[model samples]
Target chain A: MAALQSIKQNCKKVMCIGRNYADHVKELNNQRPKQPFFFLKPPSSILLPDEGPVLRPAGVNMHFEVELGLVIGKQVKDIKAEKDEDALQYIDSYLLTIDMTGRNVQEEAKKRGLPWSIAKGYDTFCPIAGPIAKSKITDMHNVEIYLKVNGETKQEDNTELMLFRIPRQLSDISQVMTLEPGDVVLTGTPKGVGPVTSGDVMEAGMRINGKEVEEAHIKVE
Target chain B: MAALQSIKQNCKKVMCIGRNYADHVKELNNQRPKQPFFFLKPPSSILLPDEGPVLRPAGVNMHFEVELGLVIGKQVKDIKAEKDEDALQYIDSYLLTIDMTGRNVQEEAKKRGLPWSIAKGYDTFCPIAGPIAKSKITDMHNVEIYLKVNGETKQEDNTELMLFRIPRQLSDISQVMTLEPGDVVLTGTPKGVGPVTSGDVMEAGMRINGKEVEEAHIKVE
Candidate 1:
């Protein structure tokens, strides 16, 4: 893994998995999906670490869920995911990202069977950090993901707790939507999700064996 | 536009409107939304004019939705749409496109309150044609849109019937998701949308005053 390019320039779509962690599903009172469930965030919503603050829409409850972001390295479709290694080859790098949500809007959309684009796609909503190559982490399933707001830990979880792991998610998603190089996949968030108001600062990161591999600092305004 | 580049290279995301026509709403038994409703289609699903074919997944009921595609000329956000004129400046070109959907998958997702990504994000799901410059169409709202499957008309309607016109859709959508250069906004489809299977050839296009301005020839396989 050498120096990587900026995601803002290379990425196309942000394919995201939802409810991959059972506890997070329980926390949201959402039914655990039988198969891998997913949604998408537009590339327009991608905000680099130094781009600017994430604007909290007026009259909307904004929340943050930190997760590991996989950068697809090649064009792949219908990948067989009998083993994690099969899907791992397609990932060239990773990032730490915050999937900011309009919680109030999302709740209404969910209840009314509406698409979540508006709820999940405000400008600067997705703040990203690190394209740490896949080689940085020896085991994809053994890393720790954490997020803090105003220096208070709100979310901390291990990837091992994921209900539908990366391999299955990639394989299932690729079967329907072709995974192209430069495309990103946000592996679902963990439990302990909460809201963040204006003037709040969020610090999210990924760690391997207690060593911080990547982190993102974001502000809400 | 002077012979525009391929959409697969220039496009970032396909922001689409849903239930924008009264007749289409009645046919689907969906309530007319008070505001503009939108969803996203990844750039990966974009199939250019010379691109091969639209592949229908096994056991999926695929339906064709012909629409007027607006190509954003420049980056715009929070566009005011008290009138369509206020938003028309953002559009540089237009396209005739079909929003292929997995009707069965969508119906189930709608029933379970799930996201519609899988139902709408399949490869070759978005087939497009024509970058006919904005100058070609005298009135955006007065254009005629129609689609035929195997030479039989399945959908036919006029943009004048749109519940929420383009300007309003763009203005409302830009308020949430920033529209960028090359990003496309597919105005919702009309009534008489039916199933398209393997070996069906879909010819969809837009017209003004009964004269064809643009057309798309898509083969399903």
Candidate 2:
């Protein structure tokens, strides 16, 4: 197996999609958003493959949602949705990554109308795979993403099911903040998200045209 | 006047306090939070003092919030509240910064139980002055913070009014995410935050023991 490429040191931010998959939205009982909703995780939250175990915070219900990660290749700001094709030119690569969440804490925050920082921004909460060049995936809308916990498949879906596609997401986000080189965007997650416990081994992977493009593994501590 | 030192390049993450001042909370008609509420802005959002005209996004009601900024000098993780005094040791400097916000967007997000990224993470939304060594201020808890728009005083208060002081905020945040060198923490704003229109000149400053310590100005474009 090849060594996993870490985006930790160079990554400036982790922009995440919230409730982008229809099934996942239904499962979580969340309203379908009119526009793409996003939150952020600090670069310090990134846990590289070489890093040993993913620490599960005590007394919190930690859940895992695997999503496709896009690495921005150039600077982008105030990009219009109609010019999404030009915005696509800013993407450099893709990979599989986990958006770890403290589900219970998030629910509490939502109830109180507070920001979701502590629920989604803990250290080692984001685990990513080695990068696969953007050219490797010819169809951005049809790739498959999956996650398995303790060898049991939990989440499996195709990018075709996303409520908001990559181009629109990038364009919309660029309109808000500039996307610089090495900044990451997690393109939402599918259904079947569930809890993970200490001593569990998790695997997340991506496939294009039925060919495995990238995968990563991490053990819970 | 000396040239303003820029932390924009080296800054990793910006952790912000929400509703930390009682007067500000009342001014916004928000309930007092039992614990500190935080949101994040990307490093790319940072605009240095000398960086000319702060661009105002069209169709958004942009607001200015002046707060005390803390620059972490050492690594911190999983620190306890009782050890907050030790956590303060990691802070090397302070500055006055604008936590620029999109008021309408944030209200909409709060109503939908969504994150405040787009509301608080827009490019050039965070304008910071050059850092002041922590040693310069004899009393961190009693420093004065003030902001002016078009030469009219808008916000004025002392750090003594903050519900969650610097040590508690830093210690609480470290328990979730590691505070690395160059990471900044905006310790919430005081009352009198309001809108900024094009052509407006905004100035924010801080004083310790009635002596001006740091101040910076930017024109709204």
On DockQ, the leading prediction is 1
- For each candidate, the alpha-carbon lDDT, in order, equals 0.84, 0.83
- Pairs in steric clash, model 2: none
Q: Stretches of candidate 1 above 4 Å error?
A: A1-5, A214-221, B2-5, B214-221
lDDT per residue (tens digit) for residues B86-114 in model 1: 77789888888889999999898888777
Candidate 2 global TM-score: 0.94
lDDT of 2 by residue, B1-221 (tens): 12335466667899998999999999999999988878899998888865677777888898999998888888878666544356568877776789999999989888878888888998889988857766677677788888888889999899899898777888788888998888889999999999997788887887777777734333344
- Candidate 2 residues A152-203, lDDT tens each? 9999899999999888898888888899888999999999999998888888
**Quick one: how many clashes does candidate 1 have?**
0
Interface C-alpha root-mean-square deviation of candidate 1: 0.9
